[model samples]
Target: MKRIPMEIKVLIAIFLAGVISVLWYVYDTKAKRRAEAAAPTPISQPIDP
Candidate 1:
């Protein structure tokens, strides 16, 4: 059996990092939307000085 090269390993790591970041962004966006839906509505009022 032959050993793998360090450059290949580095490339694999970078690819994995990119995939992870994209997944995280998607998950965070969904969570934010859900939170906004669940949040209470603000009362309507006129501002006075």
Candidate 2:
């Protein structure tokens, strides 16, 4: 069995983290859009001075 170098391990970790973050951002945006679409619009009331 061979041991991997620290630099390669660090690079792999960074790459994986970047990929995960991108995926999370895409999913979060889609979820937010869906939630916004399902939510009802609020009616504004006239304020008397």
Candidate 3:
């Protein structure tokens, strides 16, 4: 078995974090679009004094 150094481990961790963050952003944008599409607009009614 080969041993990995601390620097390589740290780089791998950082790379994984970046990939996860990008995926999350893509997912969040899709969710927001779907929610907005499904959401209804509000209407204002007139009130008499």
TM-score of 3: 0.78
lDDT of 1 by residue, 1-49 (tens): 8998999999999999999999999999888778767867522344469
The sequence of per-residue lDDT tens digits that candidate 3 reaches over residues 1-49 is 8999999999999999999999999999888778767867422334458
Q: 1 or 2, which is superior by TM-score?
A: 2
- lDDT-best of 2 and 3: 2
Separately for all candidates shown, the number of backbone clashes (residues 3 or more apart, or on different chains) is 0, 0, 0
Model 1 regions lying over 4 Å from their true place: 41-49
Best by the TM-score measure:
3
Task: Give me the displacement of residue 27 in model 2, in angstroms.
Answer: 0.5
Candidate 2, residue 48: lDDT? 66
C-alpha lDDT (0 to 100) for residue 27 of candidate 3: 100
lDDT of 2 by residue, 9-42 (tens): 9999999999999999999988877876786752
Q: Which stretch of 10 consecutive residues in model 2 shows the poorest summed lDDT?
A: 39-48
The lDDT values for all models are 0.83, 0.84, 0.83
Model 2 stretches with alpha carbons more than 4 Å out = 42-49
